[model samples]
Target: MGKFIDLTAADGFVFPAYVAEPAGKPKAAVVVLQEIFGVNSHIQQVTDRFAAQGYLAVAPATFHRVKPGVDMGYDEAGMKEGIALKAAVNGLPAPGVLTDIQAAIDHAAKASGGKVGIIGFCWGGFLAWRAACLLKGLSAAVPYYGGGMTAPAEIALQPKCPVLAHFSDRDH
Candidate 1:
């Protein structure tokens, strides 16, 4: 349902992205950010689901800078590894991952020739919110259980586009 494609960032960094296209014409475009585990099967399935809903979806490999081609499961060990990777990547700097995400957004806009939106889970959720505040040409954003967004500083950032965020009470 989806295929891996490459995208280049503003600084010439190249990374792979999984793109799922709708059968007919796409009504809109969406940039699907991956969880801490990278662009794994679940993320691909989510992208495919968006495609099925008449949107061209693209999930960029945000972890490519630190560890390329990471695809882990939903086990305890996977969670631990994902946490470590997220910490390492987060410590680097701002705009590092954001640049990659921008590449995805640009690709989606080019592919669909219409408004682009974003949706993300966990670590990706934080990114989705950040993108809403920082990136341009976005129609809307949806973030699911973004733990980082709980920070006061993150919440202070204003979004340029409309955002709908989801949080679970049990999540920490």
Candidate 2:
């Protein structure tokens, strides 16, 4: 089973991250980013899956900057709340939630003592893409149907590491 732990960012902001350690030694670490929702159960399960694959996994709570303890469902009400929360985070000054993701990556690398990568879905995917381009200490990045990733500005940004993006025809 995985448990929640605290990770401090470069700016001294602390946040909760769901971490799952492998049974044996970890081959690497994978930082899992949440969807539009917060670090909910599904994201935690993804972290567990990574651990099962012999990787250290960490999923940070991306919404903690605006609101603490945000766990919502997939219903319309949840979607509505998530969007508003995302906007609030986006509205924050530069390097808002990105700092939190960096913290997760930093922790994963140290705790696992190996290379680090990142994966994300939906809104998290967009962040993952940006992280690949802007963050440090990542070996690779995968963004599953990253929202707004195809925008002119986002597409123009060069990635610091290799990136594998997954998108469906419905994203357009």
Candidate 3:
């Protein structure tokens, strides 16, 4: 239902992305951002689910710059390692990953004929919001449990598209 593909960023950085195509003609395209764990099996499943819903889906490996092919479990050690990796990537320059995200969005728009949306979880959730604000040509955004997106300054970056955000009361 899905396969891995390559995408080039604005900076000419090439990275891998997981793509799931709908069985029939697509109604839209969705750019699925991954958690801090990278484009793992769970993310792939999500992409497949979106594809099953009649949308072309893609999930770019946002951690490629710092650590390529990162797929970890949801155990405590995985969380610690994922947090560390997230911190490491966070230390890099602004919008580096965003460029790759834009590449994904561009692919999605082309695939769906300009009707594109983005959805993400955890760290990817924050990125989904950021992508909404920073990237162009998005029709909508759905961010689930974006932990670090509560900052006023960050939220001030208005989205170019409609956003549907989901949060857990226990999430910080």
Candidate 4:
């Protein structure tokens, strides 16, 4: 249900994204942000699910700038590696991975000709929250277990779009 496409950011950085299109006309578009493990199979499946539900879904490889083709499993080693990668992205200059998300949102809105929304998990959730606050062309945001997003600074930033945050009671 999905395929890879290259999107160029405002900084002329091109990255790959997993895109899933619905069978008929789409009601809207959704940007599915990947977890810390990058846009792996699970993320692609989520995008496909969104496409199945009549939305054009795009999951960008947010880790591409730091490490391309990351597809780590849910193991201790993977967690450590993913954490390191996320930290690297965090240490990047201002507007690091956010630009990639903006590119995906812009593509989704243009391709589907409708409003765009974002949803993410884990580290991606934090990025999604930032996108809602800093990016353009987003109508709504949903961050599931957004790590590091509850800080006072992050919470104080006004979001440009409405946001729905889902947190697990047992989250680390």
- In model 2, where do residues sit more than 4 Å from their true spots? none
Clashing pairs in 2: none
Number of clashing pairs per prediction, in order: 0, 0, 0, 0
Clashes of 2: 0
How would you encode candidate 1's per-residue C-alpha lDDT over 2-119 as one tens digit per residue?
Answer: 9999999998999999999999999999999988888999999999999999999999998888889999998888889999988888876777889999989999999999999999
How well does candidate 1 score on lDDT at residue 90?
86
lDDT comparison, 3 vs 4, better candidate: 4
* TM-score on alpha carbons, each prediction: 0.97, 0.97, 0.96, 0.97
Query: By summed lDDT, which 10 consecutive residues of candidate 3 come out lowest?
Result: 163-172
**Candidate 2 displacement at residue 155 in angstroms:** 1.0
Report the C-alpha displacement of residue 160, candidate 1, in angstroms. 0.2
Highest-lDDT candidate: 2
- Residue 33 CA error for candidate 3 (Å)? 0.7
For candidate 3, lDDT tens digit of each residue in 3-62? 999999999999999999999999999999998777889999999999999999999999
Model 2 per-residue lDDT tens digits across residues 27-121: 99999999878988889899999999999999999999999888888888889999999999989998999999999999999999999999999
Measured over all alpha carbons after superposition, the RMSD of each candidate to the real structure, in angstroms, is 1.1, 1.3, 1.3, 1.0
The regions of model 1 sitting more than 4 angstroms off are none
Residue 95 local lDDT, model 3? 76
Write candidate 4's Cα lDDT for 1-172 as tens digits. 7999999999999999999999999999999998877788899999999999999999999999999889988788888999999999999998899989999999999999999999999888888899999999999999999988989999899999999999887554
Of 1 and 3, which scores higher on lDDT?
Answer: 1
Q: How many backbone clashes does candidate 1 have?
A: 0
